[model samples]
Target: MFATTDNGLSGTGKPESVFISWLLWQPRGADLAVEALKEVQKLSRYDDSDPDITRLRSLFVSLAGADGPLH
Candidate 1:
């Protein structure tokens, strides 16, 4: 949902690759969130001190909407 736009995309090389990847994953966002959460849960067993984890959680919550996923 983020890495590209209808107007046009910028950057090159790595950024280009990442943008394409984001576009590909946009349709699987919810599944991505669930998998990310599952990964965090697994990592929590060892260490969950990464701030990136928090950011990932927040991004999913925002995407899920203020009320979150239905049911």
Candidate 2:
């Protein structure tokens, strides 16, 4: 059995775990990053009222298109 929470994945433990998963799963190339950004954008379109998600969507947009060292 698993506990449920407001966030997806439920009682998986620390909030940091969700962020860590994102860090580890981040897209490697520009192409994949663009796709990832699109997906997040789609999610935002569904529910723009969530401040946290809106902020994340903004970050994705800001990072999506860029040239030269992304490092």
Candidate 3:
């Protein structure tokens, strides 16, 4: 299961301390793609008035494309 830290960053609960451990631990390509797509979709729904959201949406789009099917 995914767990967050007290500071809101992603955490492994011990040893490693990072906010993106889940991505590293995902077992399947399909699962990673689906999770990435969900994040992209959420970012796309952000308010137009938020500049940070625009940057985030662009970043997510880049990452989604990078994670797309290789064959």
Backbone clashes under 3 angstroms, per model = 0, 0, 0
Worst 10 residues of 1 by lDDT: 7-16
Considering every candidate listed, which one attains the maximal TM-score?
2
Candidates in descending lDDT order: 2, 3, 1
Model 2, position 56: C-alpha lDDT score: 55
Write the residue-wise lDDT of candidate 3 on 1-71 in tens digits: 96565533222243222215545765665566566567777766657565455545555555567545221
- Residue lDDT tens for model 2, 1-71: 96656654233444345434655686665475666466565645656665555555555555566343222
Worst window of 10 by summed lDDT in candidate 2? 8-17
- Better structure of 1 and 2 per TM-score: 2
Worst 10 residues of 3 by lDDT: 10-19
Model 1 segments more than 4 A misplaced? 1-23, 28-48, 67-71
* Best candidate (score: lDDT): 2
- Assess every candidate by TM-score: 0.32, 0.45, 0.44
lDDT of 1 by residue, 11-44 (tens): 2224334334644766643575555445445434
Off by over 4 Å in 2: 1-20, 27-32, 66-71
